[model samples]
Target: MIELKDVYKTLDGRKILQGLNLHIREGETYVIIGRSGTGKSVTLKNIIGLMKPDSGEVNIMGQCINNMGKEESYALRQKMGVLFQSGALINWLNVEENVALPLVEHQRHLSKSEVQSIVQHKLELVELEHAGKRMPSELSGGMKKRAGLARAIVGNPKIILYDEPTSGLDPVMSNQINDLIISMQEKLGVTSICVTHDMSSAYRIANRIGMIYEGQIIEEGTADQIKNSQNPIVKQFISGSTVGPLTQ
Candidate 1:
């Protein structure tokens, strides 16, 4: 389980997260939706310990990560995986090598062949086994995202964080990524937290959706509740309307 309690963050005198409280159960897909610059991506960074909240606690798997030492934090990180918006693949490395990078760095006990096998398995999981020898530039946008997904799960992490997974893709490619996410979750049963502005993707894959506005989670519920919510902010956001509390 992951929990954030009264989390507050500020950078250069600007508040990004304010008293953000959230709980995500294991083996569940939680999607966070918000307009641009609403601190959606910042929340993911805080969860992964890449950014520290100015106040409040970030607890992952019952451990207060904010107070953990470097060694402890490193150990905790091994249990989590992150898929950045751009895939963040190494330009010089082949697909398999990119996926195996995490395992090679963290699990030194595994021989080269073992790492390769693990890489192959993860690639197969993302339906990209044949593209293992291809570079990031050689793959299409969807393919690159799949490669990134393959790399994210190479270690069989308990939790996976996706930051704008469908950002720059067309609607078709976006849906394909959503289907892949749903399939992978069912196959592996990993806890997923996806931060995206794509409501269609959220409705398709998320078991529960949280709407963030002005640095706070103003509404959260099942997809149906979000769709029917009478809350002005929620309605406005779902409809993509420029007129609402958010625009003020």
Candidate 2:
């Protein structure tokens, strides 16, 4: 559903992505693993149309987004949802209003009843139906993430981008978030691209995995293939080793 071909991008004279190539299929959860500053966020930005590569193409849902006009780009981005690491909930709005913000902004044609119906369904999907009346400060870390997920899917987006979905949560809550990511794939049939440093969460949620190094994807495969990979960089990162190619 998405492809980045021979993409090269530089920011402020520093090359962040160099000849980076990636492909993700429909209805699959693809996880990207790498050390910090390895262009994971850069790749996500390119996919979301926030940043354009100086060279190479970003294809999403059949359109070459690199060349789209302003209106076209805005329309295209409506099909995407991003769950940032912080959950990014609005501090002022209650959970329900936060979840309904997308519809309020982009889908203003809908009636109040329709908006409420969508908000309610999304809350239930994320298992936060009863918490809709609560404020962001009132929620626990995991609850906030689930509410954010609800907001992301409220518009029924085709692709969901997860940025450290389990960050700042305990293991039990992390597992819950992982399960929700898997469930989103199975139930909503949406393409997912997740970038995270948590190997355990990556193993749990990814149908396929790729490891990025020095701007390009050095390895790509199924979760098991990635787990069993013999590449020194992959092994060292996954093992949490102190001494390896990455450290050197």
- Cα lDDT tens digits, model 1, 148-215, are 99999999999999999998999999998999899878999999999988889999999999988878
Q: lDDT of each prediction vs. the true structure?
A: 0.91, 0.95
Say which candidate scores most in TM-score. Answer: 2
Candidate 2: residue 190 Cα off by (Å): 0.3
Per-prediction TM-score to the true structure, in the order listed: 0.98, 0.99
Q: Cα deviation of 158 in candidate 2 (Å)?
A: 0.6
Model 2, backbone clash pairs (residues 3+ apart or across chains), number: 0
Model 2 residue 22 lDDT?
Answer: 93
